[model samples]
Target: MDEMTCPKCGSSMTSRTLGAVTVNRCPSCSGVFLDRADLADLVEAENDWHRHTGPLTEPLPRITADMTAPPPSRPKARSYIETLFD
Candidate 1:
């Protein structure tokens, strides 16, 4: 297969489709290349989505366990709770 060079990172670009448009995408740099019509279509679609979206919408925050939070202190002795409760 023919390979296309990524303009940003010099990596190989692969073809990816969004809706009806085919765009050249660079996996390494996460870049998308589109022609004039393709860009226009993307912008129009984005605007349409924003226009129809509710004003109260807020971007969700990424949820991750706090690594700095000390790991659960292992019980110094086997708890009787597990044996009795079981």
Candidate 2:
């Protein structure tokens, strides 16, 4: 395993392999330490994994404008039967 130092805090970093890509993570700062090329490689590997896993599940449908439109407003109501009782 290669040794790497954290760029932010200068703390020693540990190497880890997530999925198929290798990354260096900082211990003290809890920050991921990866070079530009390593970051790109990690993203590419993740995308490749997703591609092989097939398409993701469809997202839930969102409320449309028609569904969200407010109902028609009406004037104050008066009951004829109530008026007769009164």
Candidate 3:
């Protein structure tokens, strides 16, 4: 197939194949061109991945006030020379 030009930026697009699907991506603008078939294939692949990795059983820990609080600043230790002067 001929190399595609990005419709958004008019930049030269590179062809990348994921499994049997071929997608045109613009290096300049990071835009991807996907037809219906390509989109369907990608969606199917994502569904398969989700199916293999089961949903999380436990809820993730929520951020609390303590967790968000800034850590207490410690006093700077005096250097050996400063201590000798003291």
Candidate 4:
């Protein structure tokens, strides 16, 4: 294991290797440490997992017409016979 200083607090960080990548974490600040390669690998894995699982689904809310508005003041439309006479 390699040792590094925390950038935020300058505290000693502990290093550990998981698989092929190395990670460092600060005990005092509870911060995670990762190299550029480690972050890229993590992002790629996350994207792949999301692709296989498909997109997430969300429920839509139901809508109803309002009944409180006043009715139309104009008269209803005339039939074809009534219109021919007029």
Candidate 5:
């Protein structure tokens, strides 16, 4: 495939395939780009994942002042580009 340049940063972008869909991603800014067919494929892939994984959240625990838990430490947030390929 020919190298594609990022429209936002002018850096070279890399191609990644998720199932039958191929997307271009910018390494510098973590941007994702997809064509119409790829977008449709990605949407279908997301729906399939949701059908298998069910809801992503769990039931909230009982809330009380004394029982309050410390704020959960967050990991570095991943971009949608990273998520789509994973």
Candidate 6:
């Protein structure tokens, strides 16, 4: 299973809502990962304590087999829904 692990520290992160933004925040480091879609809101939010490490315009790309493992010997077929979703 995929875990929302913090990059700054190896702590397990929890979801938090700052105004209208939902992000993964590390309690140990007080660092948060913002959803790209929510960044505009983050900028306009009333709070002024937040700082971002880098651009948070989008969430991390989903890790597929191509990223984590060697390619298969042959191409695998995609499901109907997978095709539609992709």
Candidate that scores best on lDDT: 5
lDDT of 4 by residue, 1-86 (tens): 45689999999988766555566779899788788998786666656555665555889545557646557796532332222122
Clashes of each: 0, 0, 0, 0, 0, 1
Span of ten consecutive residues with least summed lDDT in model 2: 77-86
Instruction: Order the numbered candidates by lDDT, best leading.
Output: 5, 3, 1, 4, 2, 6
Off by over 4 Å in 5: 55-86
Clashing pairs for predicted structure model 1, backbone only: none
Provide the lowest-lDDT 10-residue window in model 6: 77-86
Model 2 over residues 1-86: C-alpha lDDT tens digits? Answer: 55678889999988766544556768798886666877787667656555666546998778776676568896422432112112
The local lDDT score (0 to 100) that residue 64 gets in candidate 2 is 78
lDDT of 2: 0.62
State the local distance difference test value for candidate 3: 0.69
Please list all clashing residue pairs in model 6, or write none if there are none: 36-57
lDDT of 6 by residue, 1-86 (tens): 36788898899988756456776778799786877888776655423423322345877778876787656785432321122112
TM-score, each model?
Answer: 0.52, 0.48, 0.60, 0.49, 0.60, 0.42
Model 2 TM:
0.48
Predictions: Cα RMSD each: 18.6, 23.1, 19.4, 24.6, 5.7, 17.7
Give the candidates in order of TM-score, highest first.
5, 3, 1, 4, 2, 6
Give the clash count for model 5.
Answer: 0
| Of candidates 6 and 1, the better by lDDT | 1
Instruction: Please state the error at residue 77 of candidate 4 in Å.
Output: 64
**Any idea how many clashes model 6 has?**
1
Error of 5 at 19 (Å): 1.2
Worst 10 residues of 3 by lDDT: 77-86
